[model samples]
Target: GPRSESGALDAQPWSAAAVAEATSAGRPVLVNLTADWCVTCKINERAALSSPRVAQAVKQANAVYLVGDWTRRDDAITRELQAHGRSGVPLYLVYRPGRAEPDILPQLLTEGVVIDALKP
Candidate 1:
């Protein structure tokens, strides 16, 4: 289990296989696509994703957290961005159990927003 700089939770590196496995097992997944130079990403990490309430919510939901760092050129991350119709970093997606599509969160986040998204 890997934690982000904000120490929000144990976030594993993003991988399609891992995400698929979690989804197939009826587990919630939170995917964070960010870059080192992205200010908004940093803000979200510190303001919302790192909140203790958010961490508790994630744990209570038994969710899997995955982070995709776009600090460099990564084909997999590029593909994901393209698939999601984006060309930049700071993408937040929450996949719930049995859901085919994930909930795309806003660029600016708050503790309440993250907590609400984690709700069933």
Candidate 2:
């Protein structure tokens, strides 16, 4: 949950509506579907999303970063997971500018993976 000029992974809470708005405006958007108890999510955050290189990439891309916490049973989050054909946490999705669909990332992440996703 670090704060910086770059789009930090935990900088803001997730909002499905905001994702739609930003994408509609032609901006890249990153969404992390995490849970408090999910070990993979934490690992990905520390290894990739929180890395300096990835953060810079996000800033350079002018992307909107959002984190969805599913600590407890939340209907909206459940639906979102279902929509993506997922049944668990640590889902990573990138909605690039002008794209109708988001690019789904691996459960495990890397700095290069995130940086590449921010490419113009």
Candidate 3:
């Protein structure tokens, strides 16, 4: 089971093993790449994170929410962002655990948009 609050999906961290588990279970994963001081990221958290629809989807899917912290400038993550062609925080990716590809979400998030995406 996922150890998180009903609406605190973004507040949690993800391990590679957890992501693998979700994929192995045929579930989707939600990856939120953000720093501590990104305004857009905070808004996304407030808007989408608190939405009941999103919370329900997360609870039901047991989605692996990967939050990569870039506040301190980690070289590994820097390489990842560069590889992805992204140079900023608040990057979101929804991937199927075992799947190599991820359906990436933009930095801006709306409740309806997230809910629609989470529907299976």
Candidate 4:
């Protein structure tokens, strides 16, 4: 995954094991599953994830930000999408520490919604 120039998130490369490790260590994780050609994904990135409030909320929560790029049909990303019952791009998931499941965000994002999702 490529890092964004915006200072809001330190986007890391996505991997199943990395997610497991972060959650196991009691850290909240935010996974943004997006693609180069996904209009919705681009919209969310600009309208919500890039918002100062939402960015600050994520930073304040000490969340691990991971971005999975499905622009090239990666198998791991495909498996993850299927596991989440999704077959397309622009999926958002928040994995809270000690939680068995992640909170799924809508394809259309808002600062308030993203801030709420990052809440401990």
Candidate 5:
């Protein structure tokens, strides 16, 4: 697992294969699909995802944090967005162990929101 300079969990590049592997192994997974130019994404990152409480919750849950960058054209990311009936960035998804479908989180977030989502 990667750690940010602030010691929070650093998100890895998103990949369908990695997501599948984590889920199959019964690990919790958090996927953040964002773009460099998305203001809302940046806000959410600072307000929630970057919080120490969220980081601790993730670490306690042993969840993998994966980020999909949509600043550039990415066919895989586009397909993933389409799969969830979304056509843009700022998509947040939480995959719990043994779940077939992920829980889609709101575009806006708070530290409590992320911490609650990671709860078993």
Candidate 6:
């Protein structure tokens, strides 16, 4: 796991505890599945994530930020991707707590889109 500026993507050993807890507490989990080698990933960093709206939502929603770093070759991540039916970077998955399905955000996100996800 790599270090994230926010809690969700913070340094980790890939513990689902946070996600489970959030879901248990009636909150959705927004996950940023990104890769260092991806240029679009970098763009997302500057465009969507860096926006004030995004930062505010991070704190307002107290959403757990989880980051899947595809910069390297990790078997677990690879397996997770395969399970999710994808074999690439920039996969965004938002799991609404208690819902049977998760809302998969697009490969390219903006401040408005991210904020909308925070809404119930």
Model 6 poorest ten-residue lDDT run: 6-15
Name the runs in model 3 displaced over 4 angstroms. Answer: 1-7, 15-17
Worst 10 residues of 1 by lDDT: 1-10
Residue-level lDDT tens digits of model 6 in 1-120: 244433232322333565677788886777777777889877886788767777677667766666767788677677767768888877777777788577887788898888888777
For each candidate in turn, the TM-score is 0.93, 0.89, 0.79, 0.93, 0.92, 0.80
Give per-residue lDDT, candidate 4, residue 23. Answer: 93
- Tens digit per residue, CA lDDT, model 4, 8-80: 6778878888889999998888888888899988888888887778778888998888888899989999999
Clash tally, candidates in order: 0, 0, 1, 0, 0, 3
Whole-model alpha-carbon lDDT for candidate 6: 0.70
Clashes of 5: 0
Clashes of 2: 0
Query: Which scores higher on TM-score, 2 or 3?
Result: 2
CA-lDDT, candidates in order: 0.86, 0.82, 0.70, 0.85, 0.86, 0.70
Error of 1 at 85 (Å): 1.4
Worst 10 residues of 4 by lDDT: 1-10
Between 2 and 4, whose lDDT is larger?
A: 4
Write the number of the candidate with greater lDDT, choosing between 1 and 2: 1
Q: What is every candidate's alpha-carbon RMSD to the true fold?
A: 1.6, 2.6, 3.5, 1.6, 2.3, 3.0
Clashes of 6: 3
Report the candidate with higher TM-score, 1 versus 6.
1
